[model samples]
Target chain A: MLKINGKPADAAGLTVAEYLARENFDARKVAVEINEEIVPKKNFAEVVLRDGDIVEIIGLMGGG
Target chain B: MVTLEDKFTLGGHEFTSRFILGSGKYSMRLIEAAVRDAGAQIITLAVRRANTREHENIIDYIPKGVTLLPNTSGARNASEAVRIARLARELGCGNFVKIEIMRDSKYLLPDNSETVKATEILAKENFIVLPYMYPDLNIARDLVNAGAAAVMPLASPIGSNRGLATRDFIQILIDEIDLPIIVDAGIGRPSQACEVMEMGAAAVMANTALATAGDLPLMAAAFRQAIEAGRKAYLSGLGRVLSRGAAASDPLTGFLHD
Candidate 1:
């Protein structure tokens, strides 16, 4: 029961990379944050998810 | 004769093209074409929560070697803006940022005070902070003092496409502010962009005008030409204005009738 973008998902033991791949996100295009701290790209594969872990993914979008 | 070699430098980064294209309100597929047509070496973008349903990503469309100016558009306060800027850097988009803190819903006005605060914080963090603000000289000075890489004064309200409604106010920033003056927002046409550059603006940022246009690439090209033309004219030094009577371009002695 991990929170990804405020929605609960069963990701108790998934690495950041696994979660991204499972969710069908192109890991190269997004920046991941865990519990208010940004996880740099180099650490995505090693950073593991636990119960109630909050994940926020951000991407470059259209803006003025 | 200001060629592309006369590059504009902001925050220690020299850009060959002064036109900064905004990636907003347009299809991602058109971004490359628009950027190429505008000859923009710097492009601005906004960060948002990744869409869970769609696999589409705008970053994939941006060409390599172009600098990314990620903006804090949705931030309503200084701290929020800071968070957004930091996140953008962590995303590996580099340190260039456009601080836009707008809480006003009606007019969509930038919060200048918050912008200054964000600039002070981010500038110390080594981010090249470019804050958008209303055309006010005092605030512009404050921003410069706060280590802002550049001061962006609006021509009018955000997304209005009204074109330089605050001409005199913007002129003051251009006159006194030592930092680069990039005119942002409310510019409706290529001619308006040209007009501001002619008034000595360092550069211009336009989005709504191109987004709403029927032909985005064509409009981008138009803006590129206009900005170049205006910059050349400003470099050439415009002639003085007269209150009464016309000044003849050719000498009176050279007239055929004489």
Candidate 2:
């Protein structure tokens, strides 16, 4: 049970890359953070999502 | 004569256009047109939770060669602002971050102290910090001491389109602060932008003015012309005003009737 974007998810053994692919998120368009630390794009394939880990996926938006 | 060589340097980048456009409250399709019409070299953007449902992204619309200035609009404290800034950088936009820490949701006024703190931290990390702050002299001084690249003072509440309610204080920052004074927020019209430029502001940033206009691209062009006109006026030096008596521009000694 991992918290991805404040919601509980059942992804306990998936790598960050797998989670992003499953969720249909373009890895290039979004930045990933696990438990308040940024996960660089190169490490997405190796970093695994553990239970209780918090994930935040952010992207650029219209702003002033 | 003002030449093309006249430019303002921000965070080691030189910009000839003094109008900074905001890419909010409007359609993404209009961004390119607005940027072209406004002649803006720098534009502002926000970072947020990526929408899984939508495939379109704002970055897809921005034209090439324009610099991105991402803001921390949702952060309520220094740490939160720092996190947002780091995330914005991770997105590969650039190192420029506009520190906008706001605790109040109503007026959306920036928290100056938190902004100062964020500026200090981000500047230390090599981020070109541009803190949007309420018009206060002491805080502007503090931000300069905190290693800010520029000080953005609001003319009024954000998105209000009230137009330069904080004129005198903004003028103070322009007069005293060594860094570039980019007037942001509540500038409703091209005239207001021109007024600030004439007051020696390094640049003018607006979003709601164009967003709410009947024609966004046209208004953006108007703002561009007004900013350029005002910059030229400032550079050429404004004419003096009369104190008590009227000064005639024509020769009084040799009138046509006389």
Candidate 3:
């Protein structure tokens, strides 16, 4: 599968677990919104990757 | 007339100050200095799922002798909020949970429906749920029914610094809701925090106003003095918004000249 993180799409056949294992995303502090709605935390590693899906993850900043 | 040493009590916690400080945004030294200078006993910190070292590492700054208040500021729904609250209990550091359900990012508006749901679940778990809600009287009442320790209504959108933007709604909350009402957000300055306290809010939480200052300690001390002044003013009870009554130096209209 082809995937894009933040910007460019790259050739990716890695499972969700493998990808997350490879990446350094603050999984506990980050919330992923796919196509505008949120993805459940439990499914972060279960859902396989696909091409052209917009995924945005937000984390807590050091503010009020 | 009320006195200066009056204590503010809610959910069985008694705090001497009318201000609540946030444990986010500032450095440990800054936070420590400001908190100590401000005499803030109640502090609000957020709980997130990420490992402490990776995300906002606020746990290290939990000051001694101050009550730790954990808020679910990032949780999108009731379930996530509940899970966070439970984790706090398991950690055995803080049983008090501050619930904030922000479904949107642009306005950071409170999702009243999901907040109520989370409050109910967390409260049932015997957690002292202090929910951050919109300044809605109806929802405040609902949260009280759900066993919330207190109701924290935003005076304005989070981090707006607009200052008491929901004054009228807040007054309504004070009138109708039995729970202690704490103005939680959009307070950008010491004066703003004071004004909210003077309006009879049990407490106010300030973050940006303190963290963004050129000198965080001085700003925090200013807020401390302001909060005390406001609390005192609230206790003394202002006679009217605007009314000038002159004291009798000799006599008023003695001869009725007019």
Highest DockQ: give the candidate number.
2
Q: Give one clash count per candidate, in the order shown.
A: 0, 0, 2
Give the DockQ ranking, best first.
2, 1, 3
For model 2, the stretches where C-alpha displacement exceeds 4 angstroms are B253-256
lDDT of 3 by residue, B1-258 (tens): 666468877678787887888766777656678778888887776654343245334545557888777777777889877766665554443578888888898999988889999999988777888898998778888899999888999888887778888888988887788777888888888888788778788888888778878998898899989988888888778765436666555867667677
lDDT digits (tens) for residues B97-155 of candidate 1 = 99999989899999999899999999999999999999888889999999998999999
Off by over 4 Å in 3: A1-63, B1-5, B49-57, B241-258
On TM-score, the leading prediction is 2
* Candidate 1 C-alpha lDDT tens digits along A1-64: 8888888889889999998999888888888889988898889999999998888988889898
- The digit string of per-residue lDDT tens for model 2 on B1-258 reads 999999999889999999999999999999999999999999999999987898899999999999999999999999999999999999987999999999999999999999999999999999999999999999999999999999999999999999999999999999999999999999999999999999999999999999999999999999999999999999998998888888788877886787
Q: Against the hidden reference, what TM-scores do the models get?
A: 0.95, 0.98, 0.75
Ranking by TM-score: 2, 1, 3
* CA-lDDT, candidates in order: 0.91, 0.95, 0.74
Worst 10 residues of 2 chain A by lDDT: A2-11
* Residue B43 lDDT in candidate 1: 91
Off by over 4 Å in 1: B254-258
